[model samples]
Target: MSKKILVILSEWGFWGEELVGPLEVLQSRNYKPVLCTPTGRRPRALPPSMDPGYKDPPLGKTVATPEMAEKVRRLDDPSNPYLANQRSLKAMLPERPYWSDLGELGYPDERGQMKMSYYPLRKWEGYCRARAQAQQALVEEFEALLLVGGSGPMIDLVNNYRVHDAILAFKQADKPIAAECYGVACLAKARNFDDPRSIIWGKHVTGHPQEYDYRDLAGVLDPETGAMLSREAGNPDRWVNFGPPFYTLEHILRDATGPEGGVHGSVGRPHSVIVDYPLITGRSTADSYTTGEKLVEVLEKGLRRYGW
Candidate 1:
């Protein structure tokens, strides 16, 4: 039987190669990938990511090679086999409401202990439990899970509760979980229910570094009004209007991995990927292909250690 992998994409946008590179490796080896999104919508690619010749304003150059650029174009094409017949996340794992009705549960209040009655609170709790259970079952069908990255993931996947639960499921199963670029932030955020610590609380990993961060125009306000302009409209160059990244991936990963865990900043170097048992992380766009190949190794050969 063909190996199956569960692939999650951001609804906003995804870096083209982050999805295509690893996919090429998986498909070449006959590993079937199932695509999913937060709301079951077809994910889009960022404009800069789709154009091979487009100069990254921050990097002052184009990141895609002719060969990889073509791969991205093929994957984005509506006629692409992988995308054309893909299913939604909701379809793969049906989600139900937490509680149909509310009831009085004897629980402590902010002031003291009391029987609290509320709607949606208990239901929300139940929903989380059911959702987590469903995700665990869904993950069991696949050999591994992949979280593709881009600016979009910074918006959606970072704090997505569903994505966190899915990661937890994969971790529990001891299956490989791979992420690229900003997708690595999800790993730093995902934590077990009983523990407040992150999943990578003591693991070494790599992600987009400070050197890779863009010069955010959003950091500065209008000179006269002292008010920020509309991010999409106020700035034409797409640089001076939007706020800078709230957190650097490298710093966040360093903190999440704890003092014992290491955050490898492979910036200014060749492409890099790191494997720490069940977790595989890539630094940036350049690392996408290598990330995929490493994931394949982990799944096929049970690779436990790599690039430090």
Candidate 2:
């Protein structure tokens, strides 16, 4: 039977090659992709991703080629079926139940003193029911989940609990989860409330390194919602100077993996893709296609672990 994969993108902006590179491999392998966003808005590739002339400051060279740039534009175009057909995470996933909504087992007393206890009844029960239903549906429907990367993830994905829940659900199902660049940060932040340690706490992974990070970041501004993407919307003709990445991916991944695990970046190698079972990761744009291929192998060839 053909498999279906959930391909998530940042509504603000995604890097051109990150999505296009891996997506092509999946499609070629007869894997159906269901493109989705945090809120269903059409995700676009960053302006720099669409410009072949845009030089990567950190890399100190031209990154976007004309052919790749064109592909990104076409995929992001609303007229195209890919961007036109997408799902909203908000509508698909269930929200977490509030701690204060424990019914008879909760709520403070009139004296202003706190009075609360833990119980699995009332509203909490109903919430758990709905949450179970949603998580089950996702796990049964998709074979795996892929989070495409870019600067936009810093704003829309890193702290998104909806995304966190999805990651947790997939992990519980023992399914592979593939992420690239900044998207790998999502794995670092997706953790259980009780444990707190990231799921990748003891797994080898790859992510955008501190050295690859840009000293001066630029992002696109959404005209409608005024959300920042990958560039300045006002200054379309030129790049605008803005704050760099919110945090370094290498640092976050290193800390998330702790002393036991490791983070392999492109310190000496040109590309880095690490597969520690159900957790496949790519260092940056250069590793996109390889990450996708490794994911396919994990599914079809019984490949368990790769790259420490």
RMSD in Å for all candidates:
7.3, 5.7
**Best-fitting candidate, scored by TM-score:** 2
Lowest lDDT 10-residue stretch of candidate 2 = 106-115
Displacement of residue 184 (Cα, Å) in model 1 is 0.3
- Model 2, 206-236: lDDT tens digits are 8988888887764644624534433334545
TM-score of each: 0.81, 0.87
| Model 1: how far residue 194 lies from native, Å | 3.0
Question: Which residue pairs collide in model 2, if any?
Answer: 219-230, 219-231, 220-230, 220-231
Off by over 4 Å in 1: 79-81, 90-125, 217-241
| Predictions in order: lDDT | 0.77, 0.82
Best-matching candidate per lDDT: 2
lDDT tens per residue, model 1, 221-275:
3323322334554565533433457687888998899989999977678777999
TM-score of 1: 0.81
TM-score for candidate 2, residues paired by index: 0.87
